[model samples]
Target chain A: MPEAVRSALAIAGKDLRLEFRTRTGLLSAFVFAVLTLLVFNFSRDQSLISTTDLAPSALWITVAFGAVVAMNRAFIIEKEQGAIDALLLAPVPRGAIYWGKFLANLAFVGLVEALTLPLFVLFFNVPLGPALPGVVLTLVLATIGFVAVGTILSAMVVRTRFAELMLPVLILPFMVPPLIGAVQVTARLLGGRPLTEVLGWLRLLGTYDVVFVTLCTLAFSAVVDE
Target chain B: MPPEAPLLEARGITRAFGAQRALRGVDLRLGPGEAVAVAGPNGAGKTTLLRILAGLMRPTTGEVRLADGRTPRDPAARRRVGLLSHQSFLYDDLTARENLHFTGRLYGLGDLAARASRALEEAGLAARADDPVRQLSRGMLQRVAIARALLHEPDILLLDEPFTGLDVPSAARLRGFLAAQRAAGRGLVIVTHHLAEAWGFATHVGVLARGQWAQLGPRPASLEEFLAGYQELVDA
Candidate 1:
């Protein structure tokens, strides 16, 4: 691997270890995801909206909010002891630091999705037998798009007084594109629609991922620079 | 780069925050085997200057450069500078050894395990290497931060109040360590409030007041002379 990638991976690994050791951030996100799912399960009028109809929206909504919770911790850890300055002083490209945080957030959000999926199925009674692959693909692509945008926004608000509140406010707008894409693709997939029909949404999600990832990676240096 | 070139140089460096200026037209040159101790009152911009020198912050109007004419913005050039700020720059959950290992990885240094081990031993934290940083005392945390700063072996070191939390023994050890660094031809710019800390090691001593150097020159011949000079500048 190239040195930058190696450094990025090292950072990601370190972040993962810290998360696993403390478990506070991840646990809170997981609990939030579960609570969101429970609220959706209990409040919906089952006669009007079948489990199939509610599954996609419920899952995507949980993910969108859960992601905000997870990404909020991304830069908060660095801010704790002012570790971000040390990271900034290192002889590595700024893009590497951006990618490191991006990848780490990707894993964090991905794990939340993974843990939430089974509960989502149990609560909604949604059969994901044939559409599991499509659902997984939608999850990955949409996650990349939102996490790409979220990583940079997290860094931007980390220095602010109201970072915790500011993150969801700034991030929810950007999360719209991918959340809509994921819900559309997932709803169609679960409704037994053909794969051919969901291709447009997938393409939109792919484009969003590529465009935002590149733009955010480029903007990160300026965001973190003093 | 010529052998005689200053290891670290800054010219006309100024930084401002909105309506307030923190530093203005400050300049410094640090040559190999030389140490400069910068003393100043509160709000003198000593920390700001150190941050700019460490490349953690860019000056609003001036520039800092390395021996080869490369600015701190260059990744390669940044590798030659080490910084120890007031913040420990350590994760509370990680152990001391892990912190060193992580820093080594950031610098792309090889033999991380050995290097971290040696650094822990040198800081007298080998027994506590595996303990989480949150469990260490303030003095121990400072020691770990110092070790982390020096682990990569940079050519120039910019330390901001490095002795803040150190005990008497640790402070003496740090002074000895810095003297050894000077003996090894490394350049140092140490920022401190106490003049005694810089007494024997600093080849030059300067005072910063209101964001500019009030007085900057060679070390006075005696402690009394240096104290008198420092008092004169602060009083002015």
Candidate 2:
């Protein structure tokens, strides 16, 4: 394996181990997501409004908010323990550090989304049989986009006095493009729209993921450099 | 004959934060088997200088180079230097052994488990290796921090107020450990306010005032003489 990949995996593994030990961040985000799904389920009557129509927006909103909660804790731990300095002092490349944190956050947010998916299906009463594959693809792409920007913004705000307040403010604006793309694609998949019809939204999501991931990776070194 | 390049050299380092200058053309040279103690008043740019030397921060104007002529900014050069700052740079949730192992992995060291175990023993924390860092006392934390810094066995060690929060016995143990490192020919730069303690170990001493080196040279013959000189320099 390449040194960069090895280093990244090491960091991701360490983060997962710590998370496994405490489960504080994961548990909080999971509970919040479940509650968000429940609130959406109870708000509307299924007879008047179709479950499919509401499922896309509800699922996306749950993911976006839950991701914010998870990413907010990503660098806060490092800053609190001064582990960021130790990381900086190491010979590892800055991009490795960013990717490591990105991978860990990706897994965390992905887990929350996965756990919430079953609840979403049960609450909305939507048949995800053939649409499951498309929904999974859309979720992965959208997650990459959400976590890419969320990871960088988390690092930026971790040192500030009002870090918790600052994360949503800094990330929500950049999040709009990806969130919109994700919702449209998800809605199309749930509605069983032809793939050709939703190709534009898929492209939008792909472009957003590629562009932001590259941009954030390049910009991370500057963010962490004192 | 030209002087051989020191193990580490800082040439004309100057740093400023907006209108305030923290380091003004500060220069230093460190070689193996030498221990330099840097003493300074508050806000004398001690921390800034150490950070620059460690390549954690860039100087406004200057450069740091390793003995092999690699710039401090180079990852290869950075790998050769160890730094222990005021912040322990430790993960409170992780055990001492785990923290050291984590650092070893970051450095890509082979045989990490054995190395971490050795470091744990060296720090006198072998019995508590599995305990989380947050559970440890300040002195124990400092000891673990030292272990973390030395885990990679870097050629030079840069320490900032390492004695802070250490109990008397811990402090003595640390001094002895550092002395051993020096004896083994590792370069050391220690920043402290405890003149007496510093004098006991330093072969050379420096004083900084207002972001400049007020006086830097060999250690004075006695603490009284060093104090008198330090007072006059700060006053002047």
Candidate 3:
């Protein structure tokens, strides 16, 4: 493996180990996701809005907010005891550090989504017979866009006075494009529309992922150092 | 590289935070095997200077360069420097051994397990290696942080208040370890308020007052002599 990749993997491993050991961020995020799903399941009357219509919005909403909760802890770990400085001072590339954090956030958000999907299905009675793969692809593609943006934004806001409040404020606006794309694709997939019908949204999500990931990686050093 | 080129150099480094200037036109040069100790009152920019040299923060003005002509901002050049600040820079949930192993991997060191074990043994924390850092005492955490900084054995080491949390025995061990590092041709820059601690190993001494050097030069002949000079400079 390339040295940079190796360093990034090491960082991701460290983060995962810390997450499992403390179970602080992941647990909170999971609980929040479950609660959001429950609220959506109960707040609406099935007689007015059908489960099929609400499922897409509910799932994406739960995932987006839950993701913010999870990504909030990404830089907080480094800020604790100022470990970020040591990570910055290492021989690894600055992009590697960003990539490491991004990878870890991706995993955390992905895991939360995985846990929520089953509960979402159970609570809302959404059908998943043939649309499972499409839904998964939509989740992955949309996640890459927001998580990429969130990783860097987390680093930027970590030093701010009200980081927890600051993160969602800054990240929510950026989440719009990808979230809309995700919701549209998910709604189509759940409505039994063929995958070909959602290709435009998928392409938009793919393009967003590429652009934001590259921009975030390139801008990470400036965000952390300055 | 030139035979006598300094391991690190800073020219007129001035760092300002908005309207408040923390450092003013500071100059420093550290050659191989040499140790420079910087002493200053609180808020005198001692840590700021160290951070700038470590490439953790960029100076508002001026430049810092490694012997190889690249700035410390260069990743390859950064590998040649290690910094131990007041914070342990360790994850509290990770064991001492795991922390060392993680650092070793970041530095791309070969034989990570062996290096981590050796570092744990050196810190005298081999017995407590498996315990999470949150379970360790302040002094033990400091020792682990010190071990992490020295794990890769960088050419230049930067320490800020290294002796703050150390016990007497650990302090003495650190002094001995620093002397051995000097003997091995590694350069070091230490920031401390304690005159004796700086006097113990610094071949050169600098007194900083209000972001500028009040006095900076070779070590005085004796601790008493350096103390007199230091007091006079701060008094002025």
Candidate 4:
């Protein structure tokens, strides 16, 4: 319903505003992602690292690492300020909160991936063309999947004794499937493989996004209810 | 519905953490506009009981029912109940008004802006509606939590340590708020160690030791006798 959407957007908007006003997390994610990409590019020769070779792997890897960094800070301030309880008590569907967080994190991660993509292209001379849309779509799916797992895990670990150390330890293994699918599809496309040849990976990625998102929605109440 | 049906009925509620028992076969009730104060030392399962009623935690052995015959058989039914805890469950990132609107929406209230505005006004936070909750003092934050509970006009309001961190003024205002809510035909339950504060507003009082209810009913006319009874329960 519109009411739920409004509430979800309100929670999401508040989060986005907080993140924007204090760009510390997003900036760190961007810088770390760019640094990783740079390191990857320089490690190989220009001929070996071209769009045909490194474009797919580099883009998805940068995205994966950037999202992981950003996810750690997702609930950092909320837990510190004791604001999460208020959000949990609101009447909005628990699922909408999931959407709000997923979308907000999506926007931030996507921005980093967007910014990092061009740099990757420029550095590796990967021809972006029509393939760009497919890549962005893949990025969105992967980001949603990653942020879904991240938001729930972040909420759980944020208040624990050692949050920063514990979150990645719990979340990394679960994130592997999405990251692999993202990198594989990107690589196959950059290698000039036909969409049909790589469509199965995209299907797997899409399925992961849908299934995990639904699971997160159903299970998020347990996370905040604690 | 039986005229004698307790306004709120808790039956066979049991919760445990590891090998320790927080609550075991606890049963209690509150009539309309009545108050129940739960007194117990730490680790007595007082909080665990409140959380279970608020749907934050599930009972290991029992169920909560509306004495008015409106049982909380499902999620929708449970949403109508209110709970205020020591945690001051306010999102510090949101303004008082924003927080109200958000909670109101969760309760499926339309015209959230108007309800939020009215609740803020009622709580005397209307003037500071736009200020983030973190900027407010502990007293003001408590007021915001109270406003959120009353925003939906729930039939049952649960207060757990409502005055623990409050200043004198905030505590007085909250007592007034609870009395007014009782006047509104809502059942009020206060869980606390401050028997004096509980006596000030609650028409009914209960002593909970370990996991059992030792004494629960109308406040004895003689304050001295009730205090003696309370002390006896604590010591025994």
Give residue A216's error in model 3 in angstroms: 0.7
- A1-226: candidate 1 lDDT, tens digit per residue: 8889988998898899999999877899999999999999999999998988889999999999999999999999999989999999999899999999999999999999999999998998888888999999999999999999999999999999999999999999999989999999999999999888999999999999999999999999999999
- The TM-score that candidate 2 achieves is 0.97
What TM-score results for chain B in every one of the models? 0.96, 0.97, 0.97, 0.91
**Model 3 C-alpha lDDT per residue in residues B1-236, reported as the tens digit of each score:** 65699999999999999899999999999999899988988999999999999999999999999989999989989889999999999999999999999999999999989889999898999999999999999999999999999999999999998898889999998999998898899999999988687577788888899999998888888988777667779768
Question: Judged by DockQ relative to the true structure, which candidate is superior, 2 or 3?
Answer: 3
Q: Which is the winner by DockQ between candidate 2 and candidate 4?
A: 2
- In angstroms, how far off is A77's CA in candidate 2? 1.0
TM-score of each candidate structure, all chains considered together: 0.98, 0.97, 0.98, 0.88
Instruction: For candidate 3, write residues A1-226 as lDDT tens digits.
Output: 9999999999999999999998888999999999999999999999999998999999999999999999999999999999999999998999999999999999999999999999998998888778999999999999999999999999999999899999999999999999999999989988999999999999999999999999999999889985
Model 4 chain A worst lDDT window (10 residues): A81-90
Q: How far out, in Å, is residue B136 in model 1?
A: 0.4
Off by over 4 Å in 1: B1-3
Please say which candidate is ahead in TM-score: 2 or 4: 2
Give the winner by lDDT: 1 or 2.
1
Looking at candidate 3 chain B, the ten consecutive residues that score lowest on lDDT are: B226-235
Model 4 alpha-carbon drift over 4 Å, by segment? A2-10, A42-52, A73-93, A155-159, A218-226, B1-4, B67-73
Residue B144 error for model 4, in Å? Answer: 1.6
Superior candidate under DockQ, 3 versus 4: 3
Here the TM-score of candidate 1's chain B is: 0.96
lDDT of 4 by residue, B38-142 (tens): 778787788888877766676878888775455553445556678887776666666888777767756777788888888888777888999988899877888
lDDT by residue for model 2 over B139-216, one digit each (tens)?
899989989998999989999999988888878888988888888988999999997766677888999999999988
